[model samples]
Each structure stands twice: as structure tokens, then as C-alpha cells.
Target: MQLSNIAHGPEIRDEAVAFCLWAPLHQRVTLKIEKRGQWQMKRLADGWHRVEIPGARPGDLYTFILPNGLEVPDPASRFQPNDVHGPSEIIDPTFAWRTEPWNGRPWEEMVIYEMHLGAFTEAGTFLAAIEKLEHLRRLGITAIQLMPLSDFPGRYGWGYDGVLSYAPDSSYGRPEDLRSLVDAAHGCGISVFLDVVYNHFGPDGNYLPHYAPIFSDTHKTPWGRGLNFDGAGSRFVRDFIIENAIYWIREFRMDGLRLDAVHAIRDDSHPHILCELAERVREAVSERPIHLIAENEDNNADLLARDAQGRARQFTAQWNDDIHHVLHIAATGETFGYYRDYAGDGAKIGRALAEGFVFQGEHMPYRGKTRGRPSTGLPPTAFVSFIQNHDQIGNRAMGDRMNASHPIEAIKAIAAIYLLAPQIPMLFMGEEWGSTDPFPFFCDLADELNETIRAGRKEELSRLPGFDVNDALDPICESTFRQAKLQWRGAIHNEPFVEYYRLLLSLRRKWIVPCLADARGHSAKYDSDGRLVCVTWKMGRSILHLMANLSGEAVDTTVPNRKDIILSQGDIAPDRLGPWAVLWSLAQE
Candidate 1:
């Protein structure tokens, strides 16, 4: 279990602790311990400053003073006690094991439930989230994918604009509290995953540009300058990002990482940063199964390719937005923006179900260019399917859930289809009980920056239908953050929706999971007649079938005859399928 020297931060020696800082731009660097004497750091040749402090223990607050007299926290700080701009706290990484060593569950058994820590509960703390683990376990969720925990500015945000890559947000309790949450989850037989952003740092509180060459001059992303992955001073930059991924998996004991928007990561280096990060993480942990999921809009199948042994070569899976787009349009008929590429195309849904992507090297009118590569070579497990997620719900003009405006029957029909499909299934927070609580994009930053965000959000969503500027919530408002919190009391009355999800998950575990390990790529055949989508997958010796009519009128479609009926929503007759009807069955191949 060798670790990388790129693990930059305070490292506790036998008696004294060694602190290292990578400041290439600075010739003189000083380490300042709060209420203690300041020490001059020795400069190393590779742009790193080193200092050793005797009698320095955990809980000591420290910061680095550059030659220009500006202070900055450690880029790899383990914890921040007082937000992003505050001092970094020394944390003892030791934790007592309450459970036996968790080897982690197989990827085939993953039923992911994505959640935001701040909005997951009223308390919005890691300890508070531990209280709800039992509820998720009972709901048959094998994996809990936590939204980003990296420290961001102010009180609340989606965790995407995180400046401190290593520190968990101080707003959500201490580092030990997060460890307890993960320990408790592992004790309950649930794998914990973390969402991580490495493409670019947040807009505010990022002091890297002042001290280090972290951004590339040639490349730019949607969020402005991209990280220096293939630039002149990129070796250390790539090492920094790769080590962050390793630190999360090795130190925090996270079972996996959901890389946010990997398409934005531009690297021309051989053995790209994505590849190197995956390889290093796999090398660091071998006792447990470590899954790496990506949110790549490019629909690049090469990232999710498998070896000859049927194991993933790089990433384990990706968030399949194609299936989500087609399903959303079928349910709500809203075809604005990217949804236009999938609107009125029932075959796109079939392709997303059987194959992974709908636009596999095909022209997408929305992007005005060809999008995605061939994805049919990948297994269905390589894609994760979901009806609603944070981006899908929060990115809307009103931040509304599908259940907020669509019919219950329509939502249930899509749920039955994806929940039973061969691909992995993920649920947004409070989605199991048909929660309509709006998870609008909320953030707290400087007043000037907040105004910019407010205006930007309004301008971006103003073109969409039914968007009213007067009704739009200010993203900077504290009340906007509170509005996104989950209301647990609403679930008490939504028992039917809860039961439906539980039943679908239970059926998946019993009927689908057992055959998934042997599931192969290009083993599914699908057909669609505008609205009626029928797909069949060859899972081992069993044949799994799905018939869905996403139209308002009943369709005269022949239903496949299978004695082992898994589940059915709406009317399913011999020759006529009711509006919004979905039927799933299994039979001998």
C-alpha cells in the first residue's frame, strides 16, 4: 500500500510534523501557526517548500505566507475549520473500525441513490445524515452517491464551485463526522461514493493563480480556464489532481468517485489524466472494489470500455443522460434546449435502453454538430440510468421535479422501465417517495458575485418556455438554499410511491442482479413505432423484456408472452397497451 509523494499536506512524523507547500512562483515562503512562532520554510528544487514543527499536534491552525505577504491555506488541507479563507486545521486521520473491513459490494449490485449533504436533512450536517442511512438501506439502495463535499464559499452551494479540493465543507460538521457517516453506511452494508470536480476550480476563493501555474493558457472550459493537464508546468498539476482522487479513496474510505463533467477536462498528454488517475486509484486500493463513474456529456464509450475479462479498463460506468433526456421528453413533452435532440423520437429511447447512447456519432441539432462515439460495444451496466438528478431538476428555470408537473402514471411508467433495465439505476434525493421538493440551484458568495450569478441564471433560463423573471428565485438568497432542503414529512403520505419503488428495487435485486455479471454488450434487440418502445435483452440464459407506450392514446401493440411477469404499470391487454403503460417480464432464452 504505497502512497504518492504528491500527497501534499501536513504529515505527522514520530514526534514532529512536516508541512509541505508547492509554491513554484514564490522564492520565500513562511509557515505561520496561529498563536505560535513562525518558521521559515526550506525551498526545494521542484518548487516545494518544506518545514518541520516540533510539538505540533492535531487541532493546530496553520496557513502559508507567500513572499508577497498574502496568506493561503494548504491546497491539500485535510480540514478547514472556518470556511475557505480561514486557517487549515490539522486532523488525526486515525479511526476505530466499528465494523469488519468492508471489501465493498460488486458493481453489479449497485443501486445508487445520489444525495446532497447540505439539503439531505434539516440539520444539513454529516452526523445528521447518519440518522437517515437506515431509511435508504430499507429502500434497497446498495450505494449512496454523495454530492461533492469539497469546501466552497459562504454557507451553501451545490459543491461544484468548490475551491478547496481536499477539505469537506465546514458547514457540514467536522472531518471526523463525515468519517462517522461513511463508517455507519458501510456498517449497514451500503457503499458510499463521492462526487469530485477536478476540471476547474470555483470562481471565488481560488488563490492558485497567485501562487502556482494551475490553469492552462491554451485550453478553456465552459467555466473559463481549464486545469493545466497537458501544459508546460502540468506534471505537478496532474499529480495534484490525481493525488486528490487517491486521498479521498484511501483516507476517507470512499468506495467510488463520480467525476463531475469529465468532458471539460482537456488533456493531450499520453496516458491522459483520467487514465492515470484511474490507474493510480486502482493501484492504491486492492482489498475493495473501487468504482469510478463519469458524467461525460461527450458520450465517449472508450472511457467505459472493458477488458477481455469483462472488467472495466478505465471507468466503471457513466451517467447516461441520453436515456434521461428521452424519458423526460416522453413524460413531460418539454423539448427545449438539449431535449430537442431527443424530442418526438421514441426510437432514441429504445436505443438508449438497448445501446448506451442515442447519438452515437450522429448529428445532434441542439449542439449543431455530431455528438458521441459508438457505444453499442459497451455493456448496459456501463451506463447509469435515472429519471431525475440534481442537474436535471435544479437546472430547470423553476427547479421543479418531474412529479411536480407530470402525471403520476407517466412517471411510474418510466420508473418501471429504467429501474428494471440492465443498466445501473440511480435516484435523486427524496425521489423514492415521489418528492416534489424543488432542488433549485442555490449558492452564497460575495454580494457582487451573487448578483452576477443571479443575473446569469435568469439570462440562461429566460428563453425556456414558462419562465417568468418575476417568479425566479434569487440564487444568492439564504431562503433559496433552505427551499431546496428535503421535507421528510412529505413521505409519510406518499406511501404508494414509496411502495412502488421498493417493489421495483426488490424485483431488480431478485431477478436482474443475478444475471447481470454475465450480461454482454450488443445482446439487446429493440424496436419502436414512434411511441411504443419494446426492448429485449439476453441476460445469461434468461430473456428480459420491456414494453412501454409513452403516448396518451392506447396503442395496439402485441405484448410478449412470458409466464414470469415481473411488474406492470397501467392497463396491459393481449393486443392493446394503455396510455403510459409499461410491462416487464422474464423467460427462458
Candidate 2:
């Protein structure tokens, strides 16, 4: 359980290399070295095959050969220098870490900036991304959440389809390059978090089924068969995932991991995989702050709650879709699909601001079921609220961002509310300055699979009311990927919006962040007209008020204590707000 010597990958030593694997079903297993022949491995006591090569050293390529003469890449491969279908490479984990004794920033102090490495810069490599760390630091970002780096079978992807769980994508630079990027981020006082997929493997190049019963035929996910967690032979499968969680934090020195989707990880056992993972990750860190964030569509507030005996559950924070959905509806007034429930009537958005989730035991027509549980007593920091994230943008038919459909003032108002809210805020890459580039859905699949995915996307969009299937970009096109790249100069040209963001973030850091430690100190109220919502925060008599107007016309309403106004946008009158305006103020008394 310590994962010190019990790791399941190729371990390199000075004189001899020990390779360990969990292949209980196979009676005979061989370690096939590239161009160096093969060696039979002896089965160990705990259903793992073990082999030690005397002359093996770092940078060696190896694969596990099963009894059926099928050579498969290591399920726990650390470096897939070749594609996912090729042999795994041995990586020298030794790096001169400059930030020794690096205690990461506290969870409450994080203002995360979610980025896609390939689209973040023109170079689109790990080393190239290092140059932008200073720019992020200057923007007051405390953490950088990299989209999944695990190697998938493609030239590029949103990174959700990663099959080689341990290997960083070879399309990006080498393993050392990723380490260098982390090192540089640490040097800039930015904590690095990796987004890891645990629910299901990719469609193409997935060889897990060849080695063991890792997938459950009984349970399925949107991608395919759900991973084996509760069924027979599940202990090893669960261990595989838990070990991966530990590997990222301990080996990569990542401050935390953003678990891709917990709803898909089906487990009905006592002390669920989510709870076990949290416990194990805490034990592995041994006091260093390592955050675990979950992306759960269920809006289960208990994921962030403490149990009856006062033990932590699920994760440190959950992706609050309620917040994003309300903001989206308030901005665009698009009432189709899931957005139908969030009609921008002010009650739903107000509830989300007050208690973290709006659908707390309420019937949701979109899914035709009652959704969410009450989260009133939980800490505000337990939820991660974002105006725009990768899924909300890239998963769209056309991969359009928040600015694509909403007015500039409306976008600014929503961004202001999210940043100044008590919960942790996350900004999508290029969102600060309203980049015009569309973060369209793009992936690299085989020729046949590519055609199938393209057709499937068109069909999915055809069902949606407002979507124009013809406008959707080809997911397999090279031009689609290039079109999503950020134009950094957009930040310069959109200076007003950039300054608005910088000012609100600075104000939140100075005033709002201090109040987030106490959950009971925050409250929200919305006008009956469904156009204005005011969120108030109090930390030992220090009161901060944020008022936002979601209407399309000016509102003749009294300013909520404008004397101590710190930040104001759009038409700011003494007792009125212009269309799509916002005000952040503090109580003088």
C-alpha cells in the first residue's frame, strides 16, 4: 500500500533493473526488450510477475509478452516515447529539482488557470509553455491545471482519451520537458495540477483488455465499458487507479490532481474508491499539501462534506456546473437542453451563490430526475466555480467560448461575479482578454475512426435546436487545431477587459479571499425582477457586497452601499446600473 517498492512499472537501478507487473491470469510472461531479446519473468507471491535484468539501465525500451505471444505495452508505462501502440520507454526520474521542500499553496489560496499545452502557445510543447509562467504569475494566478498529459493514440486531443495513464504524451516533449515546466512554474510561485482520467480508457490503442479484466462488461460509460471497480477481480483494478493517483503527486511532484469524472467511476463498495483514494493520497503526501479536485456532474455536495465521525469525503473541491450553467443562461438566455433548468429567473442563480448547488433535491426536467443534495452547511471552498472551463467550451458543437455568444458587458459581469465569489475560481485559457479563437473539439484518431467520430458529432448537433451542423468544424482537420490556438496579442488589444479582470482579481485577493475561510459568513439575494443579484460576505464585521445586473436594459435601482465601491463596470450611476453592469463594494461601518 505504501507504493514505495510495490509499484507496477519498470524500476531502474544502477546495476540491475527490476520489472514488476500485475498479470495474475497469465501463467507465463516475458519481458521483451527492444533489439535486446526477451527474458522469462517469474511469478511473484502477490499475483505479480517479476524480472530483474542485470545490465538494464535508463532509456531502455521494454514490453510485456503474454502467453498468447501477444506483446502489449506496460499498463503502467511511465514513458511511451513511441506512440501508444509502440513499446514503453524507461524514464530516468532523476531531475535536479530546484524547489526542494516545496510546500504547495493552500487550497483556499488557489486561483486556478486551466490551460491546454498544445493551444497555449505556437510552439505547443512543454518547454515552450515554460516561457508563459511569468505572464500567468503577473496575472495573479496561483495554480495552473494542465489538461491531461497522458499519451493517447493521436497527433492531438482534448486529452480525455489518454490510454497510457503514466506516460506524458510523446507529441509534447520528453518526460524531462514536463518536469522542467513544473520546475519553472514552481520557481514562479505557481502550483501545478495535472488533470488525470481514471474512468475509462481510450477507444484506439487500448491494450488493457489483452492483459486483464480491467473493464466491466456489465457497466458502461459514455466512452465505453466502465472500468472494473466493484465486480470480481476489482481489487487489483482499483489499486491500479489508486496507484496512478499516488504516482502523480509523489513522482511528478504535482501539487494536486483534477480527477476527470467521478460519476463514471461506478463503485458500490464500502468506503468507495473516492474515499479510499482521498485517504491514500493523504497518507502518501505525508504532510505536503496535495489537493484533489473532482469533476462530478451529479452535484453531490456530500463529496466535499465531512462524515458523521468527522472524516473527509470525496475531494477538496468539486466542479460546480450549477454556477457555470446559471451564468451561461443569464448571459445568453439560451433555454435548450440542460440550460432549460437554469432559466436565469434569479432564484436558481441566487441559490447557487448562497449554497453552492441550486438543484438541491429539486426535480430536474432536463435529466427527468430529482438532482443534488443540500450543501448549505458546507464550506464555500468545497466547490470550484468557473465561468468557463474546457468542457463547457470544447465540448460544444463548434467549440465556441463564453465570449462567442454573449455581449462583452455580460461576459465581464459574469467573470466579475465568479472571480469575486467565495468559492475558488478557475479561468479557461485565453478567457481573461476575450480571445477570439474557438476552442473547438479536435482529436487524432485512425482514418476509419476519424470518419465515424465526425459523423457522430454532426448527428449529436443535429438534435440540438440552435446548433447549425454545417458550421461545426471538422474534428479531424489540422486547420481546426490551429484555429483554436490563442492569439496572445488579443490580450493587448482587449486591454479594457484585461484590466477589468485584473482589478476584480486583485480586489478579491485583498477582501473576498479572507472571508472564504468561514463558510457561514457569506449570503446572497436576488431582485424579484430576475435581473439583479447581490452577494454579501462578512468576515468578523468586514462586509463585502457584489451586485450584478443581468438584464439587457438599465435598472433604476438604489446602489448597494456605493460609498466604498472598489470596482465598477459599464454605466455606474448613483442609483442605477446600465445594462449588464457590476459593482463590488465594502461596508464602511
Candidate 3:
């Protein structure tokens, strides 16, 4: 895999350990080991400083003193015992994997469950999460998509604002603890996928810019300066990012990675950084199925293209926000912001189900631009659909879930459609039992940055309907972070929702997953009349049909004549679908 070429940070050997740092702007770099003697790093021609310490064992705390006397953690640090501003800890990557070697499950078998480590349980630790793996395995979740774990400043933050890309956040647990969580999940027959943010570092505690050419002046992202992926000194930057992806796959034995916001990653190289990273990761781990998913707002179907053998050419699938928008509007009828473009558009709901995207080459009024390319050529598995994810729920004025705002029937109808659809399905944490507890945006940062974020969040929420800035939760407050935690007690009261999800997922495993491996694009058709949606897919030799009435009133629609009924939600008469009703049936040709 040529992992040696991409190695950075501290490398432990049999008797000697080597430390490497890329500090192009600095002429001298000093390695400061805690309670140990310091050593001057030798400079290389390509801006890298290196030093080897014999008998330097694991559990050593160290930092690099720059030319300006500023101490900073390793850009590729494996673990941060303290926070981001603290010294990096050298970790022994080797672990006695308790589980037998696992090659990962197929992409079609994935029923993903997205979770935030901090809010997933009361303990908010990796080992604490391991205790719930059996519950997930029984719930039919083949993959557990964890939120980002990179080291961010302060106590807590959505991991998108992470600085040390390679270090797992200390707030959750140590690097070895994370490995234990993965090993434990695999033991329970569940794959672990991590969400990673590579577009930009957090607002605070990022020291790469002081020593290396990390950001490009030629490009900018919404967050700030974009990463240097195509500039003059971009080869090393590309290597750093690509190596981070491979490190998680090889070191942590992660089954996959969900690249957060690839659209924000600005790179004009011959092969984009996204493409390069995927290729490198695949090369690094060819023995097992290592899936790479993207959360791109651009809806670029080209990235999810399949080869002649129906294998992904680059990314395995994308988080389809289009389907979520359409389904959310159908359930709640909220038309503010981006939802306005999809509101009352029954055709979009049909297209999102039958095809992969709704805005393919169409003008989106919300963004004031033409969004998305043709996605009908790709397989249905190219899109991952979800009704409520972190962003959709947390970004709101009050992190209100779909169940909190809409009727249970409405939420269940939408769940029935997506959970049993041909596309990959993902459930946010606590969604199975109709959790009403909000998953609001919460972070702990410097006082000044916290105030700035709080004000900005208020201003953004004021634009939404019925939002009051005065009533908004302070994101930096410790109480707000605690408020987002999942309440397991609610599961007992909402057992019906759990059973509903289990039934749908079990049907998906038995009927849908087997045909998905050979499923192709442009093999589905749909018809929507007012509030009624009917879609049919030709999955291999089997025909899967879906019919639903998403409104409060009953709608008359012709039911497909197939006795192989998988599920029927609400009342489905011979010629009419009752309010919030959904029906699914499969017939073999």
C-alpha cells in the first residue's frame, strides 16, 4: 500500500521512534518531550523536519516548538490526552483485536444508523457506545455511521470544526478506546463508518498555518480559506489528507468513511482530491469492502458512478439531501428556505424515489442557481436517503424532530417509504423509538467565539418561520450539550415506532438487499397525483412497488395486483389509500 510514503506524525519502531513535521515556513523545529530532553529536528529539502529518538516508548507526551517559540500538537497526532491546545500523546497503534478478522459487509446490506458519540448515551464515551452494539445489531443496523471524532477545541463541538485531523477527540476517549469500540462493533456483526471533515479546520487551535502552507490563498470556502490541494506545495497536503483516510481504514479497521461536505473542498487538480483519496483508500485496503460515502450538496452523480461490473468507480454512495427535503415537506408541509423549492412538488417526491435526484439540471429557487446533474444513469444504491439527520434537525431554531412537529402517522408513512425503498437507508440516533428530544447544535469554544456563534445561530434561525431569537438555546452552554443526549427511557413509551422500523428493515433485508447488487438506474417509473405517490422499481427480475398518501385526507389510487405484500401501513383499501397510508408489494417476473 506504500503507507510509508504517506506517513507523518510519530512513528514507533522496534527500538527507536521517529517524529516528522512539515513546517515549510520555519527554519528550525525542536521536539519537546515532556520531562525528557529536547532534540533539534533535521530539516529536509521539502519542508519536513525529522528527528529519531532511540528508546522513546509509547505513552510519551510531546510537542513541536516552532521558530517563533509556539508549541503545537502534531497535525497527524493519533491521540490528544488533553484538548487541542495541549501536547500530543504518542500511541501504540497495535492492538490485540478481540474479534476474528472481518472483511466487512456488502454495501447493499447496509442499513446505516448515524450517531453522535457525545449525545448517543449518558456516558458519552467509546466504551459506553460499545454497550449498545447488540441493540443496534438486533435493530437491523448493518453499519454504524459515527459523527466525526477529530480533535476540536474546548470540551465539545460538532466534529466538523476539528483541527487535528488524525487525532480522535479526547472528550470521547483515547485512541485505543476508539479502537475497542470498533472491535466490539465488529464482534456484534456491525460495521463502523466515521464522518470526516476535510474542507477546513476549526476556528480555533489550528497550528498548521503557522508552520506549513496548509491553506490556499487562491481559493476560499464558506468556512474560511480552503485547503491547499492544488497549489505549488500541494503534494504533501494531498498526502496528508489521503493518508488520514487510509489511517482510519487500516489502523482503526473502519469499514467506511462518510466524507463530510465534499462540495466545500476546493481543488482544481487533474484528479480531484476526492477522487484521489478514494483511490488511495481502496488501494490501501483491497482485502475487505471499504466503502466511501460523500455528503455533497452539489448532487454530482458522476462521483457515484458504477463500473461495468456494478462496482463504484469512486464514491460508493451519497447522502441524498433532495429526497430528505421532499419527504420532510411532504410530512410537515414546511416550505421555508430550501424546502420552498420542493414544497407541493409531488413530482420531486416521485423523482427522488424512482430516480436518484430531484433537481437534475433544474433551476433551484432556493440557491438561485441550477443544481445537480443527471443522476438517472447511476444505480439506485448510489443515493442514501434519510428523513432526519443531524443537520436537518439540529440546525433548526429548536432542534425539533419530525415527530415533535408532525403526527405519528405522517412520520411513519415517510419512514415506511424510505426504509423499504431501493436506495440505502440511514436513521439518525433515537429516531427508531420516535425520540422527541432535540439534537441541537452544541459546542464549547473560547468565550469570544462562543458569543459569536450564538449570535450567528440566532440570526440564522430568525429567518425561519415561528422562530424567536430570544428563545433560542445557547450553543456554547453545557446545558445545551446535555440537552442533545438521547433519552433511552423514551424507547419504552414508543415501542410501536421501534417495531415499525424493525418490520420495515427486516423486509428490506429479506426482499430488497438481495436484488440491490444487480439493481440499475433508469429501471424505475413513478406516478404522483396530488398527495398520492406511486413508484415501481425493476430490481433484477423482481418488481418492487410503493404507494402512499401523504396528506390528511384519503386519496383514491389503483393498487398493484400482487399478493406478495411485504407491508401495509394504515388502511389500504382496494381503490383508496387512507390518510398517511403506505403500501409495499413485490412480485417476481
Where model 1 places Cα greater than 4 Å from the true spot, the runs are: 1-6, 462-466
lDDT of 1: 0.90
TM-score each candidate: 0.98, 0.95, 0.98
Model 1 residue 347 lDDT?
Answer: 86
Each prediction's number of clashing residue pairs:
0, 0, 0
| Alpha-carbon local distance difference test for all models | 0.90, 0.83, 0.90
lDDT of 2 at 502: 83
How accurate locally is residue 162 in candidate 1, as Cα lDDT from 0 to 100? 96
Off by over 4 Å in 3: 1-6, 462-466
From the highest lDDT down, the ranking of the candidates is 1, 3, 2
lDDT of 1 by residue, 1-589 (tens): 2334645889987798899988889898999999887999999877889999999989999999998889999988888888889889998999886867789999999999999999999999999999999988988999999999999999999999999899999999998898999999999999999999999999888888888899999889988999999987788888888888988998889999999999999999887899999998999888889999999999999999899888999999999999999999999988877888798768889999999899999999878899999988788999999999999998876788999988988999999989999999999999999999999999998777977898889887775655676688788888888999999987788988888999999999999998897786338989999989989898778888888999899999777764777887899898989999998888875
- lDDT, candidate 2, 422-463, per-residue tens: 789999999888886889888998787988889888987776
Candidate 2 yields a Cα-based lDDT of 0.83
Residue pairs with backbone overlap in model 2? none
- Model 3, 480-536: lDDT tens digits are 988999999887788877888888899999988987866953399998877888898
